[model samples]
Target: MFDQDKDTGGLQGKVILITGGTSGLGAQCVLRLALNNASHIYFTGRNTKKGSAIIKETHDAGCTTPLTFVECDLTKLASVKAAADKILSEQHRLDLLMANAGVMNQPPGLTADGYEVQFGTNFLSHALLIQKFLPLMDKTAELPGSDVRIVQLTSTGFRGAPSGGIRFDDLKTVQNFRVLGGMMRYGQSKLAAVLYAQELARRHPNIISVSVTPGIVSTELVSKQNAFHRSTIWLSAKITQGRIYSPKEAPASQLWCAVGPRNEIKQGAFYEPVGILSKITTKYTQDEDLAWRLWDWTQSELKQWLD
Candidate 1:
């Protein structure tokens, strides 16, 4: 377990951003960072009511740190760009970014950009957010005592991706395979997240980029699932004898990655809960060529939004 008392103070004076900050693991992250005295906290969520609630909750808890909520709908690329632009215009330096918002095994659909819903919401939009903020993060790294990091939340489900990993030819359509279609799409997006972190560390050595799996957390992501899906999850947990963590307990790994000592973290590595470096057994996740390919494709696709 993460020692909140010991680790929470590490973020003092740091500027931070978190996606999907309205609830679940993301909301926990926001509260923890705010209470720890981060210089400023800028978070994004689609619901204005929930956004305001987070801000109010921080204030009610006597957290003096400035918390700003930018309304963002991750399913839309235009909204993602606008959120980035709004933050970039306000803050000169951003020390940490937590790409914590995502969707799970939902029905087949497309995002506003015409890409598969899961892949677009989970990976592509976060990619655009990272791209927009890279220059600022790079500059932040140059400052004295600066430590810049990007934390991408991935999952063990990445191992369940289709045979060839990402199906690039069919990204524009819903990858509705007959069986396990939703999981397959979810896995592909998460795989992209892991690969993106690796390529990011390689390209920007100054900034620390890493992916982490929070394990099975008892959040709306699971609780709101249909009865069948929820039962399947519980059965799997029982078989594995795994622990289902609450939202408060689940943010430990990502929080540690965000504020832990720089020397202790490996660049471009994937981690399990509370700072354990996990080995990538799947050959697809270990492919350097595929990582580069995804990076190039993402860049080409988001070129219009970058400027």
Candidate 2:
């Protein structure tokens, strides 16, 4: 699995940004792209030691392109912008983006930006990142090999959200707050991820925007949460025989979604299980107008961070 492909230069010459690079699924993306001969690899995370260590390890393992680390807490819009600006200052080209970092505990906290933990980190941050970084989306509208992409990482667990749809009246879910409140709230946040992807796909027409599930990955991210999340996962993993994927395996879908063949995959497609194009939730597929509104609302909410 670690060997380089001689025939398909799948990610060659691409400048890619992945959000949660310190551990888990995102780190796996860092490894896969490094070996695939990508021209530049930049990822964002809050851990200075681990982030720098991953960069060193990538170099030791032999990467042809420059490997970089940008520290940004996905929970904060200001931080995301700082990271994007850092990328712009450092390089002129950006070929792919994996909006993959998030926190999942059922506990409710607010980001520095003052949104709920679930919504702020997972939803608004990714939305803001894309809007601010739109300039680097590569201006090709019709040309083949013009690879520009935004891949959103959502979850099957999103289906478990009580809302089962975008809860427009309670985007933050602060009034009905409980542990279950967080369950639905987290799911609601991921809906924003998927809906955001859908919105970008429709509006841009050319950029390859899609959402994907990483299949359950066994990573340190799971352990970072409070007792509530860890207990639920522990119970779930036991019932499923604890087969959550290793971070390395989890990146299979995300990496493919970013660089996989466009003709084979659909635009605005959701993917999982090693490049298999997955389905959008039925409600989302039908609610094109809702996605558009959600996109606009997010822009309005983050207007100050847009610059």
Candidate 3:
């Protein structure tokens, strides 16, 4: 289920950063990357205890990779910047970035940066982090055989996004505000992940930027849902007996895109089902103009963090 013994020369000496690495799929990526010999693995999360446990778990498993923790609260742009700055100070090169931190359906609210919570935490902050860390990434680009990659963990929820995609005017307002609105907002953010990856790949040909859907994994993501949605899932599970992937399986597509052969991945692509270049069936997700508009809007809104 993992490339435990595969030669990791491709990842040797590489510095990797993964957000939301305290639990779930992000945790799996951290361990797997450590096993594969990433020289420095820095994972971000708000929970210091969980962070310490993850570090210890790796060591107990005989992981020799250098592991560090960067305390980051994704809902706050300032926190994200502080974490990035810490990495910039310590790591000379950032070989891979896993934009894996995100929130699912939640009550309407603003991030510390004042944007919608889901959109802000899931997409906006990550977009800024990529911008903030580009210099470090580019430094690695100068090295021979270096594969600088950014993998955005989008979701199947993207297909259910709102009618016109991102609501540019009402970025702060949640129309319904609860279950329905929360899902729509979550979808919008996930769609942004897909579009962001696409636009990033197009703009930076030297680096790899791609999004992947991990396919309905059984994790805390579902546990965050309201009771109504939970009941629906329970009933659906009883009737269809559907396949809910394990947390270990959830990071497969992401790891594949992150460490797979260069030629196998199509740059600017969204992947799914372990490892395949599946197209984003959503029309809005594939809109180049919309992607650029979102990028520009994010930059304009986050001008203070651009430095």
Among the numbered candidates, top TM-score falls to: 1
lDDT of 2 by residue, 1-307 (tens): 2222322257766788899987888887787678777878899999999998888888788876688889998777788889988888877677888998887644767678777778888888888888877776845333457778899998766665554366666655452555477677777777777778877888887788998887766776677767767777767766753566766666777766777677766777676666766653656545778778887788888899874
What lDDT tens digits, residue by residue, belong to model 3 across residues 7-32? 23468889999999999999988988
Question: Per-candidate TM vs. native?
Answer: 0.97, 0.88, 0.93
lDDT of 3 at 40: 95
**What is the model-wide C-alpha lDDT for candidate 3?**
0.84
Ten residues in a row with the worst lDDT in model 2?
1-10
Which candidate leads in lDDT? 1
**Native-to-model Cα distance after best TM-score fit, residue 240 in candidate 1, in Å:** 4.2
Instruction: Write the candidate numbers in order of decreasing lDDT.
Output: 1, 3, 2
Report the backbone clash tally of model 2: 0
After aligning candidate 1 to the native by TM-score, how far in Å is the CA of 235 from where it should be?
2.8
**Cα RMSDs, all models:** 1.2, 3.0, 2.3
Model 3 regions more than 4 Å off: 1-9, 175-179, 231-242
Of 1 and 3, the candidate ahead on TM-score is 1
Q: Over the stretch 45-73, how does candidate 1's per-residue lDDT look in tens digits?
A: 99999999999998999999999999999
The C-alpha local distance difference test score for the whole of candidate 2 amounts to 0.75
